[model samples]
Target: MGFWDFLKPRSKEHVEACWPGGKMLQVHMEYDTEKTIFTYFGRFGLTFNISKSQLTGAIVKEISRTHSVLQVYSGVDCVGTTDILPTEACNIMKDWLGQY
Candidate 1:
């Protein structure tokens, strides 16, 4: 690997959620080290390379012990929101992305 590549932090891939196509969501913790920012990066629909962001643009919340809230957005607008299991977060994100 190149020097710069060696310096870069490795990313963890979430294969459970596949989108836009062959790409899976990737999470990088404290990616830059300098900024110490955790980032989620993935592509959407082939043409767009979404960054800092996953399946990063998606938000999951726990409203109850048995149910979680899944929220997806397109830009500033919230595209979809529904209560779901925590395990369903990625799957729900895929569905919203497909529809919106």
Candidate 2:
């Protein structure tokens, strides 16, 4: 598959929630049976990569009906936490990791 294909969420809820402002231009992800490499591309030259085999968990907490927080943990460290919309986006990420 194409590099960005995995970034395409399966549901409309994911499309709206994961990319609230349409700021994401593309994404590149590579994963094997046990590890994942994720790269994010934004419209305003914003980019970051998270490649970790020690991902401990992904937690989703609701703040409102349309908003939630996604917290990512790596081993004992909280690597990333950010707000998302619709909430289902959190599950998608978690499921992606579960596959590997």
Q: Count the backbone clashes (under 3 Å) in each candidate.
A: 2, 0
Model 2 Cα lDDT, one tens digit per residue, 1-100: 3567657774333121233233352322234323344433332333444565666776777878866755667787777655444466555555655554
Error of 1 at 99 (Å): 17
Worst 10 residues of 1 by lDDT: 21-30
Best by lDDT: 2
Per-residue accuracy of model 1 over 1-100 as CA lDDT, tens digit each: 3435546775534322233222333311113333333223322211122333332355666676655655555577554454334435445554544432
**Model 1 clashing residue pairs (backbone):** 40-53, 53-56
lDDT for predicted candidate 2 compared with the true structure: 0.50
Report lDDT per candidate. Answer: 0.40, 0.50
Sum up the clashes in candidate 1. 2
TM-scores, one per candidate = 0.29, 0.50
Error of 2 at 19 (Å): 8.5
Location of the lowest summed lDDT over 10 successive residues in candidate 2: 11-20
